[model samples]
Target chain A: MAKQYEFRIKGLPYLLVLPQMVIVFIFFFWPSAQAIWQSFFLQDPFGGQYIFVGLENYRVLFTDESSAYAQSFWVSVVFAVSVTVLAMSLSLFLAVQANKKIRAASFYKTMMIWPYAVATLIAGVLWLFMFNPNVGVVAWFLKHKLGYEWQYLLNTGQALTLLILAASWRQMSYNFVFFLAGLQSVPADFIEAAAIDGAGPARRFWKIIFPILSPTSFYLLVMNLVYGFFETFPIVHQVTAGGPGKSTAILVYKVWRDGVVNLDLGSSSAQSVILMLMVIGLTVVQFRFIERRVNY
Target chain B: MKRFSLLMLALLLCASTVFAQIQIDWWHAMTGKNAAALEELTKRFNDSQTAYKVVPVYKGSYSDTMNAGIAAFRAKQAPHIIQVYEVGTATMMNAGGAVYPAYKLMKDAGEKFDPKAYIPTITGYYSTSKGEMLSLPFNSSTAVMYYNKDAFRKAGLDPEKPPVTWPEFFETAKKLKASGMEGGFSTNWISWIQLENFSAWHNQSFGTKNNGFDGLDTKLVFNTPLTLKHLQTIYDLSKDKTFIYGGRENKANPLFTSGTVGMHFESIGGYGNFKNTCKFDFGVARLPYYSDVKDAPQNTIIGGASLWVFNGKPKEDYKGVAKFFTFLSQPESQAYWHQTTGYLPITVAAYELTKKQGFYDTNPGPEVAIKQLLNKAPTGNSRGIRFGNFNIIREIEDQTWEDILAGKISVKDGLDKMVNDGNAELRKFERLYKK
Candidate 1:
């Protein structure tokens, strides 16, 4: 009799997030849990029999030298960091240019984002054609036009550079979109204030604009690093096949080769769990140490 | 009332008789030109006799088709026939009661199937350990060298003569590259053609007991000086920009046909595509060897896939499949298929018929593959690998080869690592079965 109860006010947040939570549970969490469970068992593909091996699989994962899981981890770290830095630098430069009143800005925007709209697999295929020593456009240009001897497939340094470039090319667009949005959100009044205080354009950008955009930069850095490790496999397989030797054999590709192609679920799963823990720990450290410095 | 009841009963009997056309499903991975031929064969069979209707379904690539079949089987809805690659042989063989061997099925269905009628080499690969045919060899191919005639002419080399030894191959490729060709040489399935088949072609064991002939206890043994020599040459060629390594697998097929590469090593199954696509004349030759083994001409191993009959089909459908197998075995049909597609004649009779027809004499290219295959009888290792989880072993080999070419690891260490890793995979597979 005293108080009227409101149904909409208390349960609104839950209602808003219920669909996404359900989706995450079903698609991501459930499959991950199942893979973890399978890592502990030996599965018979013929009869669907799974026998638990306790920590035997984990022990094998640690002791398997032929797999070189440790080497893969190190390679992945280097690949992730280099790709993140390169992609971030490029995208920031593009965003800054697009923000200014430049000629054909709209056309430039479309051209910059065009690669992002293409599928990763298709991009790999196109890149492979361009790098083909026999018929690749770039190979033709390098050898015939420039008169420099080049074979991207056989050279280790060149192959790795090609992988980084292809990876960065696809990623820079996503970074550009985020940076552009962040740039737009940066208050014009703040830049004017900095200028009035006798700061130059470069100084205004470095001190005033960059610090405000730190949050977006940080977000892009973490996401890009994770993607460089985990998501670049299909492209790598299509493009280099992790060659001119194993120069491009990063961690996720190793896990994929061990798991799907090799059918050694135990070692592959063990690698997956370790990789997950490493990523999670690194992410936590970043948030603890770096998140505080993000101005937003 | 009695007359009306009798009439109704008669009508019910007529309705049940019309629903008796036994339906059978076949899931295959044959696509492009091969698919067109398969459709022609199935259509002719369907029109010839109306006893049973065989429905053929295209299910993408070999691995994709097999995965789909396995999933469907678990769902209790697998096709009557599934085309599985040779690598999946051990998996199917270990799948006890899941598959009905062709001979057993034919016999049980009151059909005659003499396994001896097939080529000994062809049947041997698909047979059980006891020499019983388990599956039908549908489209088998082996690695062979394809050279551009125009490139050879431009390089001032003999068009009819191909490199018989590895040294000659390298020298010739270098010459072609120097003559301003796009690329002197490019190879596909570098792992399979250059390493796995290279070891087998030389009669060297890639693993113990001729690449796991004895079973899961097999260990790697390919870290030899000869293999090192072969790999070192490839690395040197890359430095010289004479020999180009294609991306992976059949990625280099188009390079040869597009006139971008002077010479290429690819599967004979790709012959159909090459023949159609190559604007300039091209020729086929047997794979080159290192000129060391006593009996090095022991024939190149096959690369294409075979068809396996699965269980869970109706009794009447087995009869249709067996009859279709017999029809496909006819010499004229085999010859036609061999001439149209670049796959080998699957039977001795087909080979004889093709020779009598002077098909090889007219077509110099198709004869090269046959002469190479029949050059020496296949032994255990050269016959083909059928180890449990051999697919994984192939992947490990692929990774190891990549490492070797990258200069990240020496060939000896790379192959040694591959062997150790491959054996571990086999042992894990062995453990799964044992436990």
Candidate 2:
């Protein structure tokens, strides 16, 4: 049965919603508007002088290959996709195993979620130390014992891989928590019936639990994409700093490097505007396509 | 008892109202021991005067400090002073009405100021075409070669003798390698130490318009044969691991400190950090030159930050800032700063004071940078690079250098690409602040 609730006063409803709207406008809309506005003008870092340059900032970014903003776009795509797929699948697997009624399952679940507590930048630093070529425990083992060279310093692929691993490791816990909840909520009877009907464990789970977990999966997918794009900036900043040579300069880091570090206000603003549009387009596409598959 | 307590409270209020110290906020980028030294210096300044309290706030890295200073200026809450790195000089100088020129501040405050009293090379960097000082030269450093004496010993080379020329440096590197060192040598700051200073050291122009001093529309001219040959030598060395490419910036520092590399090039300001970290006996020497070029091994340019006064502060605050700057320039204060931190003493008096005290006898490492800076009177190109968007340009240079070394691009092509790309950035800067 659906329960209908009504506010006592019309003014009360507006009052209740006013604070959220104001917060959103101040934090999100206002800065976004400013970014869009600033994109049209060239200004010094001090905001002392502003010259209107039309769309020159955007033109420079799009045309200048050496600036590497275009390269950052592809880097971000690979980074986001790799991070999303890797974190999602690994967490799903871990959640599935932890879903069993084994002894110390709660302890195992808690241990898996511990990485989620580390801040992104801190996690990056931790991962950097662990994978540092000079004197890292893992790096030492790989070099001395396995005799496989693991130098991320100059290797673009290895650097990106290490960053992706660090990024995915921190996020796995959050995905695992959601996946475990989704797994626990799956009706046991449906699973049992599918098993009784001669469907194997893989088929039964795929047909039954997987589709039922679609809602969670869709939500995680969108969140993970956003996380991959924006939240991974700290990790990228700390780990490689877009280095080995602009090989990992993702979009967000470019925006920060230009705007904050180099004080290129106009270009960074343009970048942020483009980044905003890109993410918005991405979210819209996800909801349109991915959400349609999420039954119930 | 209540009446007596009320009387005491009234007295305290009167005291607070009567004696108010003008708080001069000094935002700086110095960290660790340098920051501690700055704080102590600030305490000394505060103790010496009752009219002003100079509070030195450590504002992250140099870039972060510059950003914060600029952002705060926009908000009309700017500090009295901010330390800007040498590369940021162009950006800071171009910000009209955003900064109060140091000479003007000193003149207006009626302070006994003489720009020539400071080291010519130091003041020459932060000055205008008229040779008027723009900002107070605070902490300056130059590139120097830090050699591991133990590695030299292991290589059977004389520990006291370091390479004097580029060819000799490479030869020593070969010797180190033959003696079984993992990496013979490496360098830090591919863009700064290697290219920019490399040009100046060899009496060559890094860019046109006297390295952006004459005009904003400066074009890079460092893609010459000399620069190319230098890069080629490093590239060839890197092929055999005689010269290990240590990522970018100071990332190669660990290679030297790890003791596997014999000689490393870095800022002399790294003195404090190296002392703390290096387990082996290390010695600092002048950066090697080609030795074939005329006036080769000319004075190197300064790195590190300078104290810049923000615009639009109250008149009294500017006066206090002027006074505080005067305090920092005193021989004792400058010598202390020079000794405590690895940064150079900007004034001749401080340098003489330090020498007389025989500070160089024990800490000869820092003297190399000082001597490098003062080796010869600065020429047009040797004054150091001053171009806007240099931070971004440095990144481009770093990326290009790495690409060339990694064999992704040929040395000539990479240098050409760097020049082309860097010129575009300079054009952007020229357009932004074009008069």
Candidate 3:
């Protein structure tokens, strides 16, 4: 600033932001530090004793001959990219339709946003019921009507597709809300001018509207990627349980399975650390490259 | 002044009574009907004594409860008693100073307990290599065959006779499938029923060192010719949809109860749910085994949970725990528990008591699990498996089996993968516990 305006008291600014700092430090930093510290040690499930064996956990993870760790990484990547693209594109389509001045547009918008109210686990269960090979209605239709045996329990591709659809279904509403807000912010005069210049609806959307929505789309891309990576555990757990053969066991789900179910503390903690680094790296890249393309 | 003094004396008497009774916390994972039954039993134990009061707290699922108990132990606020599932037996046993062995708890408290009173197959699972019981067997169950008798009659097979051998079972499944049944046979807990209990029931070694009883340096030996033969048979059956792969762990129960699947393999613990849900007549039979093996159909291994006493509680609380265990061990209480929950009566006296009372005559399927357990003296291979990282091992087995069923891998390859992955987990557990 041209003129420096300082706090009257030495510690006043620190005091003013003390509550948020305390919350962030206690909830986020503390647990992350604990994970980093625990990643270096081998501990029993009871935590009665621990021995520091530096880098062994990480080494085991990277060098695992079964390639389960590496497989889960690729699974996570495929899952995240598929869910983000499907969810964002579908929601954008719906948002564009809802942004029209048609009758009952508000009603359409309200109905489209209803899925956001469902908890992730509940959404997963709902999809699971619909896709259950034994008694699922849709499965029954596919089998009886189409003469196709719908068996996701044994088909890796089918299971992955179900997970992608369920995960995207739950996230679509959130993206729709943001996309609708973004569409509303685009000045109508721009579209009108493009229309007067003899541009068709599709051409007007591509040339005038979509460029202005780049900032919102970029923001959603990052958010959707993170959600797909970390927040799809419930979907995978309830629907496929990372099976027919670990086909859907993403990195985050593996971390939970090892750490919580198997009680392999060091290995799971190492996984957590690696996942944290990957996300950090991803976000940095997104801001560096993708943000440059945003018109805002 | 006289009335005030009388009131004070009454208050003092009440306070003294409350202070004299030791309170013991019992953390359990029983839910729904079983939970209510547990609450009733706890109330009975409390009312039957003036020296102690045991409060039963509902923890989440079995694994969640075990984790919570471990966390509480680390915090030095552990409950006096915890109900740990059978898979967690090795973990609890290796927890060294964190637990007081059940036999020692009883002996130290000067309570009279006879390990011989319990069914040998039931107690053998939770006992040390030296045959010392480490945890009190509670709600024990074993895998068995469940059949829809109505489906059998509809398919023109004898409703009373279930297949006693694997070859016969497969033939019957083919017959049922030919009769237009959608799913002829299915199984829950494929790894438990098809692998662990399958090996034990066939008198085949599941692992070296008597299934990891002697030491932690155990390797899975279930990839034997017999196991491969059986898996290959199942694979062949699956090609025609005669054998449906029900998802893991009791998920197949609904298929059987809904009468969609003709025959099902599940735990005896599923008896209550089937009896209540199935519209058709559901029957229980012993698990099928290969007749070619000389020592085929040995006793099956037990599942379900046991009561483990934790260390680091007051002496008085230990005394209360011993008393609670004594009450649970009584024949009447064990029989009641068995009758109500469809779990096995752990003790011989309870089994005999229930039989004498003609409970088995009226409820025919409840006794099948008991008979399966007491059918023969358990050999080294048939007793039970005690291995580190068994939960993870079970997961790996499930994955491999699914892969095999899905045609992603051959049966031999799947079994080999299971063994290799299981051994690696065992090694990791060995290293961790060595600390």
Candidate 4:
């Protein structure tokens, strides 16, 4: 048995971590608390006047089906889930291939990882140019080469598809780096032993390699979900601007539009408070259920 | 030696007092050529004065500037003068103690400011119901139709005579589409051109309480039979490919510039850009009206930004601001800005000066804006509409309008949804101010 070590100086441990705690408290907890406090009141833009009305803002936010909030909720759901699953799976597949014995391995890996260096807003704008209906190269090819009508500006489904594709394409690079690292860290002896035991390649990957990568997979899953929830706002903003009848209006986009653009603070704050709760619940669920299956 | 040094320091302090000029902060959202025009005006003002120096700072886009100004005000570091867009007028007005009304400022400074000296239609949008000027009008524009004269000629229609009625306009559009054009006429600002200005031009109220001018208890009334008819007609035309939906908010401008479409509706301020970019001949015409409406084609409302002064500045600053406004209202400066920037001249004297200089004859495109705005005295609806959250309301307008064209919602339902959502925003604005 190894020696078990414990810190008897409780004050020293708290003192050592005090700086990070202060940073998180000031940056995260303070603003979240303010958002929750502001959600119950109808406020002006400059906070010149605020009238308290308990739960009225939250009620109005969820009640307006015709106001496009319902559609936005559904869009946010589909957007987050699809982007997380598609980006993770696709990057993982590419990472596995890039991990194999192949020619010019670093070149393929570098090419795959280059998109991570591009800003999310820049990525969105580049995709927008490529998919522009009138003069874009992709649009022209789709119409002239494939003989298909690609009208994203007015088509609801097409707008969402383009938004998801742009967001997923941008997200895949980040996922690829982690997945490649995780694949490379898997020991070589397990694979050779499984191969010697007469197991096929599919069986080895599913039973051994996949189980070993669960820690990285779980971390990526949590990260991708949180990112899908909040960080895609700029891409949605520059690309579609929550148009084509609120089809691409994600929840965070609505928060910015209402709070920042329209100055509807109460509704915006209520939406953000809901988003805060959602993130908290997601983190709890992921750590409680998913972490149990993740191998150390 | 100490006595000699003290005497020298006293002399230096006296010299510093004589050279110091009061610097007033002026935040604006003008970019590119517009910023250059504003800089020239500032240079002229600074050169003519010794006691005050005006400092103009570019603060990003209109929305960014407005938000920055508001945030600054909250921090008690607000600029002396902030240029706010027309849509931001309502929010600025409701800022209450944060704003120093232009009329009050002029009176306090004892400047010789006449409310009647300014164009009624131009100032009407920025004035109270009692005709009190809230913010000084700096740059103003109105909607006008720009048609490809070459496309009209190819369609066997008279280039000199553009369509005056809605029926005639659609007929001409169909003809142009048949004449080998890619699509029919598209519009730049669909909500402003189709709904807001549409109701005003037809002498129909956009909302109760004089389009939110009389009181804060106003709700939108734009879903009437006539407006519904117009929305439905546009929807049908879009389905038939006679009216191309070229995205929203001036994204369709290239359609007109590239000669992909026949006619386009855009702000009169776009004249300079269109002149530089268009490869074909274009003519400016008044927006088409429905013949059946009784008092159709009322004057168009202004669409550009205005200069607003914030409160809590020193009294000396207000006096300098008044002097600046006095200089800005001069006919020469107004005409120079008007001719250079393509925004309308706010004062009648400047208009006359530009006309006397034969500016209209050389540039025929801008004459249509003045003519359309002076068609008749503005009624309650035609004056202007002011409501809170108008920016997002415009987004809602664009989205719902596209939804109608996409067949997701009927025209009637879409129009109703717009009115419903718009009224909800208005109610929120009312609550914010009424408190």
Candidate closest to the true structure, highest DockQ:
2
DockQ for every model, please: 0.33, 0.70, 0.64, 0.61
Q: Going through the candidates in order, what is chain B's TM-score?
A: 0.92, 0.97, 0.97, 0.96
Docking band of candidate 3 = medium
- Which residue segments of model 4 deviate by more than 4 Å? A1-22, A285-295, B1-19
Error of 2 at B233 (Å): 0.9
Q: What does DockQ come to for candidate 3?
A: 0.64
Model 2 chain B: worst 10 consecutive residues (lDDT sum): B14-23
The chain A TM-scores for the candidates, taken one by one, are 0.84, 0.93, 0.94, 0.91
lDDT of 1 at A273: 77
Model 2 residue A31 CA deviation (Å) reads: 0.7
lDDT of 2 by residue, B1-435 (tens): 999999999999988854587889999988778888899899999899789888888889888898888889889999999999988999999999988999999999999899888988888889987788999999988899999998899889899999999999999999998888877899999899999999999889999998989999899989999999989998999878899876677878888888868999999988888999999999999999987899898899888888899888779888899999899999999999999998999998999999999999999998888888999999998987888889989988998887786678999999998899899889989987887
lDDT of 4 by residue, B139-258 (tens): 899899999999999999999999999999999999999999978889978888888888888989998999889988998999999999888888898876788877888787877887
Among the numbered candidates, top lDDT falls to 3
Of the candidates numbered 2 and 4, which has the greater lDDT value?
A: 2
Q: Can you write out model 1's per-residue Cα lDDT over A75-116, one digit (the tens) per residue? A: 677788888999999999999999889999889988988889
Pairs clashing in candidate 4? none
* CA-RMSD of model 3: 2.4
Q: Which runs in model 2 stand beyond 4 Å of their true positions?
A: A1-10, A285-295, B1-19
Look at candidate 1 and give me any clashing residue pairs: A245-B402, A245-B406, B141-B303
lDDT of 1 at B206: 72
lDDT of 4 by residue, A1-296 (tens): 99976779868878989999999999999999999999999888877888999999888877866556777888898998889999999999999999999999999999999888889899888988898675567976996699887878898788888888888898899999998998888899999999999999899999998888888888888888888878999889887888877788899999988887777778888999999998889889888867577545
